[model samples]
Target: MRRFKGFVRGVDGLTRDRGGNFAVLFGAVASVLALGVGFAVNISQLYNARSSLQSVVDAAVTSTARDLTLGVIKEADAKASVQAFLDANSAAGILQANQIVLDKLTINRTAKTVQADVHADIGLYFPLFSVGDMQRVTTSTTALYSDKKIEVAMMLDITGSMAPNWRSKTDKIGDLKAAASQTVEDLLKQNRDPGDPRIRVAIVPYAEAVNTGGLADTVFVEAEGGPKVPPPIDTPLSVSVTTATDKCATERKDKDGYADYSSDGPYTLRQDNKGKTYQAKVNRDYRMKVCPTAALVPLTADMSRLLTAIDHFQAAGVTAGGIAVQWGYYMLSPSWRSAIADACLGAGPTNFDQKKVAKIAILMTDGQFNTAFARSRGASRSQDQGQVSRSNAEAICENMKRDGIEVFTIGFDLNDPSMTTTERDQAKSVLKDCSTDDSSSLKHYYEAANGAELSDAFGAITRNIENLTINR
Candidate 1:
């Protein structure tokens, strides 16, 4: 400031000089410099205002495009959505939006092209070449809000907590059934071509464990492509039902503990056991009481199968969210297609990371995850069953994300006011860590206080997954 004052004083002295011709030249030079500086400052404000406004428009258009694709809004409401978004974001930039005209908002239902044109009269800080204090800035954006092929794995929690009435209004399980069924209908409807459904959904209803049911055939050579559950075990039988050393085939911990924790089966599933004991053959120390009773469905595009799986889901047993997530990845992974060919309907993909294919996992849990076991006795396996389960859930989610699977997590009514702080913190931590990333505080992780919130969360997950498209 002192330097600037000194500069001003020098210029004033020059203007006051007795020599008339020299004083005139210096005054003219000072005038030009001041005008240039003022122009630069004003121009910078204009640039900044335009840039901020452009961001607001871009975000508004993207949200509108997504809503349209999700069928929540039509072409008519899209323009309205634009106006609402602008109004909502009025304070976001330097200029206040006085008027907005949706000059061209086109949604080609047949061609699936969404183009939007927005013209806004924004109050400018400094006038540009256009002679007004307000600038009419027009911005446009285009996006193809449709997916080529989407494979989603939904892991629904059927643990004991989900069996009861929800808060007061709903039967929790009924709400889950309704939410999941509607999500299926919504996703399938995204295919503009009715005959060409590029969407496939898998359901993993988890309780004490995920009941792979028929898909276990892909895991055990002994079941000979058959079911692995009881004729009811009267006592711990000495005989091995499946060729699995541990008598557990469809469940990953077949020959070795390592294979149990992994989605990829590496052990000799059919080989005869040389060990004398079941534990020795299976290479596992303990046995889970029984897998969940609710049926498990692999990835399938058939809407009927998807809905049926949701209907068959009954609330029972404990929570093994980690196990359910591990199986969810298997449903989406291309490598498992060969083994799960029958369940996957003989269809297969080239690779998991294919550009056009989107692999996603939607995990919803009603209570704290309490039944997870390490594939091997590693650092993750804890004496505290709840801790181990939560740990395993996060670890499996990490692996799935690393393999390019987008993960969305939901904790439905997990916060019981009576619970201890540690118990409350555990569920939130697991859900947050299980999501794709934390860039969006509201996107990947959801906390639903009741059934309505739960349904809303599911709706959001469905739309976000549906929006993953290469067509754009």
Candidate 2:
């Protein structure tokens, strides 16, 4: 009885001791805190996994939809494709989506819609609060199926500055050819069918004037007389009356006419917008010095000929990049299909609108636009040919953008060997203004200091264009 009472007294003393109370409280709080920290870590892991799964799901569904649009995969096979994609790309265990279910795969031909609903069982790292081992993730993707085609026109500047500069020892034109050829290859690879690709490309090499080649006889209206009197819209005589042999073609200008000479219809190449009766005439000397040797190649999928055209690129003459930009716009315009003949796929889908077809222009130049056949702002600083050419380029870019054609511009070696900060800034500014103002979202303006950067610029443009056409 005495021993039992002693034990009881000891227990009572221990229980009443306040010195050990904090230890018990700390033990309880530490356990709860540990559990909370572990839960947070597990939750964060699940969130990261969910995000990765969303990306994979999006890509898989989009690819499947594209295949469906191309008739490469049927609805029955789409599930297999999606599953294979998921198995292959579970973001390296970030998304352990073990179970996949296709809730819906709707392809409405009449509506031209492709919709997909997919769900996956993503394994959980930690099952919190009696949660299951897996968490369900659902995602959907939709694409508008259309028989949209792609038309691209490369407006290359083969100016004197692009030639092999002995001082810099850089062949700018050679770099351009390589870059352009790669662009062609990339674009052609995007086509589901190579034999009859839905994509077409046109090359317009410009300097002082655009060389229409065979189209010259058919496209141009003759000079009315000598240097004194220009030709009117009527009494055409381009093929019959030219004493000069150079095929350099000039632009049409009328104060009462539109902003730029569109390649759609028969346009009269007048003298200038200075007055109504101005005579439009170019002598032989001007053509020989400024005319580019590279012949124009219209929309052709013939890869061999396309490469050959790039080979034909020879650097000569001054920069009249505006003319090239205008031609690039015209080449894609359906309104000019009558002149294009077999150049563009049937002028179907009607009008020169960019609804069904993606029209792109890649305009690259190495120097300032110092040469202009017209736009001479008489006696004022506006008469600065470089400024005039820059304005014209911006104007053409504006018009093309209005017509839904995306324009990308590049200034290559704009400031050779480094110049004053002000000069460099001006050069960059001009290129910026000429490019599509997608500065923040997608930079349409690029500047290259050397050949490698120029090639990189083309590659960047190619990727963006691919995204715009295929992934959009």
Model 2 regions lying over 4 Å from their true place: 1-49, 65-78, 94-98, 107-116, 121-147, 194-196, 218-243, 255-260, 267-288, 342-350, 376-382, 418-426, 470-472
TM accuracy, model 2: 0.77
lDDT of 1 by residue, 1-472 (tens): 9999999999989877757997788999998897677678767766776676677777877788777655557677877887788778855667565454567777777666677777667665555465667666777777665434778889898876677654654478887998899988887766554455577788878777666666554433233333222212232445433443322222344433332444553222232233322221112123465555666777766788889878876777777766777778777777666666655454643276536678889998877777654444555433576776676777778888888888999888877665577877887889889998855323799988887888899898876776555342
**Per-model C-alpha lDDT, please?**
0.67, 0.67
lDDT of 2 by residue, 28-103 (tens): 9998998798788777876776677677777777777667645467667876877787667764446544554667
User: What's the lDDT for residue 257 in model 2?
Assistant: 27
TM-scores for every predicted model = 0.63, 0.77
